[model samples]
Target: MTASAGVLDELDGIRWRERGSCAADPDGGWFEDLRAPAARRARSICAGCPVRRKCLAAALLYGEEFGIWGGLDSDQRHPLDEALRHGEPLGRVVDCALRADRAA
Candidate 1:
């Protein structure tokens, strides 16, 4: 198992239960839609998310292979996911993603 797997296991339930921008929405499933406008719509919601960092961290920690995360679509999340899988520290992954977000 990846180093993050165990840490992720212990944190998953609690982390997710913490409020996220989309959690209370009636359309929580929107984040998983891969279509063009749907991904865009989901990102809009994520953009204002108070828990965005936590959400992105969880996605990387667990290697989520689909959907929008932290206002980032699959393409945007790929590098962070790869870094996590390769044992990169979560702080470093988060820092990189934040930098990329600023540059975008």
Candidate 2:
């Protein structure tokens, strides 16, 4: 999905989280667990999430160093975080990561 201005604006707070695919799941640990199986499950859920870009943007913006956000774990998001720190636009970086995710 394109990161429109309205969507970007919504990323300012925790409100966007309500729409995440993982929001309703009782076991929130799947996203934060270092175990491979849990991470796989989290990524699978993130794959179909409608607010993935928002999720990733928020994660990067807030320096979330743990958990799977927008289908990407900490390791996958590290470079993108570095890019953001280097002055890359948050939207652009998120879009690139999502594109690469789809291609993979």
Candidate 3:
């Protein structure tokens, strides 16, 4: 489903919503960097987060423009959010990401 701003509240009943690994991180400071090393560390944390998918969905749904969510940096999330906003199918966005990854 396409996501919109403040949609995370609708997921309150989802257990992962309360189980994000970064919940206790000091304002999620570690996720703000665009540097490769910092991004790697942040992604490592997200990789272990139970709520990784939810966090990513929330970010994409809301057009979050900062920090790492669901193992993705803001740059990685941009096209996904754009696709969702434009009513593109989710699979198309995934395929685009895969193509970009392969190209890189």
Candidate 4:
């Protein structure tokens, strides 16, 4: 795990239910509202989050196909996921993140 793995992996171990794992709302299609309403809420509560980078990297490294894989929501992160899952080069994905980060 990296220094910024996030809440999923914590002081003792993985807290899957409370962290990163998703909830399905019957009519809503997907996702349970586990995060704060604003991005700052996430960045504040999760900035020094032990698994922050790891969470983001996992979304990039593996083509996780649902929910908020990293701290980012689906729309915020789908491009990188698509690129990796389609066998696109890792560098392409990295570049995309860089470009996206700037836009953010």
Assess every candidate by TM-score.
Answer: 0.71, 0.83, 0.63, 0.42
Write one digit per residue (lDDT tens) for candidate 1, span 1-104. Answer: 87667657645785563678787774654555576676667777877787787777777766777777777767888877778779889867887887678677
Q: Pick the candidate with the highest lDDT.
A: 2
Backbone N/Cα/C clashes per model: 0, 0, 0, 9
The runs of at least 3 residues in candidate 4 whose Cα sits more than 4 Å from the true structure, single-residue gaps closed, are 1-40, 60-67, 89-99
Any idea how many clashes model 2 has? 0
Best by TM-score: 2
lDDT (C-alpha) at residue 44 in model 1: 78
Looking at model 3, which ten-residue stretch has the lowest summed lDDT? 2-11
Model 4: how far residue 55 lies from native, Å: 0.9
Candidate 3 pairs with clashing backbones: none
After aligning candidate 1 to the native by TM-score, how far in Å is the CA of 91 from where it should be?
1.6
Candidate 3 global lDDT: 0.66
Candidate 2 residue-wise lDDT at 42: 79
lDDT of each: 0.72, 0.84, 0.66, 0.49
TM-score result, candidate 4: 0.42
- Give per-residue lDDT, candidate 2, residue 94: 93
RMSD of 3: 4.8
